[model samples]
Target: MTINLTLRQLELFTATMREGSFTQAAEKLRISQPALSTAIRKIEVELGLTLFDRTTRSVQPTPDGRHLFAVAEDLLRDFKVSMQGVAERASGLHGRLTLAVLPSVAASILPRALMQLQRKYPGIDVAIRDVMHERAVAMVADGLADFAVTTRIAETAALAYDEIGADRIHLVCRDDHVLAKGKGALPWSALEGHAYVAMAGSTSVRRLADAVLLQADFALQPRFEVEQIASCIALVSAGLGVTALPALTFSMFASDRLTMRPLTGPTISRQIGFLQLKGRQLSAPAVALAGEIRGAYGKR
Candidate 1:
């Protein structure tokens, strides 16, 4: 048979047992003695067992009632602990956040943001997946990550992009390269015949560069193509060839060996932001971390 016992009933039963007097229990619970007595009767009826042995001026819990009281007390204690944990998580004081971020932002902006998040919410833990832009988007879309920090590669309704900032495209080359001697922003046409170190065709950086070069009616060809940003920086630093990269990714380059100039004559920049499933709300910790990331990027 199913026992339909509410927590309120358990509370009343336990209180009556502890106080050992119906009148005193009612006073402690802030209820009328009659109301408390009626509730006790309901519990006994529900369980089909006599919970108390009572006489004039005396009340005592029966063996069965004592056993139920022990179980109920433990359950109430555990419930209280569970609710406290829930409250902490809701406040973003204790929880885990998972983010899929581009390698560039992951290396540059994310470290400072995570440090800020840790200082503000020490109980929060974070997991980071540093991947390319397309993979970062896929991770968020597939529910493999809470959110993503990357460039908006395409327009789509499935994902909502909240732009935190933008990174301008820059031409990166060794400090001794002929182009490095020029001042101010350089026109896209100026890259004409230089040996280009192109990022892999699959990368967002390559796509942006290709689009800009195509629009400028420039036909520069790659002498070296590399997939990783570090490799591109290494090649450029070694004077193998110059590469175009966004300002944020320039953090990976060795400053003493390389220099970057902003591209002009229709300057190009990529929107950097959070990528998440459209219409879904982020968890409290995710929102807090996103704020930290925005602040870190803004400071840069």
Candidate 2:
């Protein structure tokens, strides 16, 4: 036979069993004692089971009542949990957010944005992949990441780009280095004789640097090659070599031993922004995180 007891009946039944008195259950449920008894009686009638042994002095659960109560307790607990999850999803405060970013941006801007994202959506789990700018865009197109914070590219038919901010290129060198001897901005030609710490050829930064130098008819004198921006900055900080990077990168890897000088003679800058799949709809968490990134950029 199918049981037709309502959730209200089950709740009243459980409350009556727990309190062991109709008067006490009514007090806990903020209802009249007669109403509590009527609800529990409806549950007992629908289930065709005597759920309680009523006495003048005391009320106790029967053997069937004890077994049903155990099962109902777990059922109600799980139901409450499921409803809470639904609420969190409706509020856009649950789920995982995956993002790909250039190593420079991951270091410089992502941390602060993520911290803000966390505060706004504490139920969200964030995963960050710090890769080259090219890979950052590729991951978003390939569905490996929800979105990317990276520079623009010529080939973006499969992706959508939103320009959030632009970062001017700068030269990073040791404080006592010869290039740092002069004040104000330095020209691309000024880097002619310096030992350059270049990013690996696979990186977008390296490509941009090469193209800019080539356009200026300047030869690249590479002294060291590294993949991570942090490594390049560390090498420059140690007075090993000078490197060109976005001015925004300076704040993340800054050191008292190293300082940034603007690059002139056709000053170059890259547009950095959000990259997402062209037709795919972003999840709520990803949209929220994108807002955080944009807000951080606006503050800068």
Candidate with maximal lDDT: 1
Clashes of each: 0, 0
The digit string of per-residue lDDT tens for model 2 on 1-300 reads 887766677788788888889999999999998888888888888888898898888888999999989888888888899999998876669988789987778777888888898898998888989877877877887789999989887755788888898989988899899888878898999988888999899877788789899889979789999988879988888888999988777766757888688998878898898888888988888888889999988876
Candidate 1 clashing pairs, residues 3+ apart or interchain = none
Best by TM-score: 2
**TM-score (C-alpha) between model 1 and the true structure:** 0.76
At residue 8, give the lDDT of candidate 1.
91
Tens digits of per-residue lDDT, candidate 1, 1-300, equal: 999988899899889889989999999999999999999999999999998998997998899989989999998888889999999899998898789999889888998999999999998999999999888988998999999999875768788988999899998988899999968999888887888999999998899898998888777799999999989888888888888899988676568878899998779999899999998999999999999999999998
TM-score of each model, in listed order = 0.76, 0.79
Candidate 1 Cα deviation (angstroms), residue 167: 1.0
How high is the CA lDDT of each candidate model? 0.90, 0.85
Give me the overall lDDT of model 2.
0.85
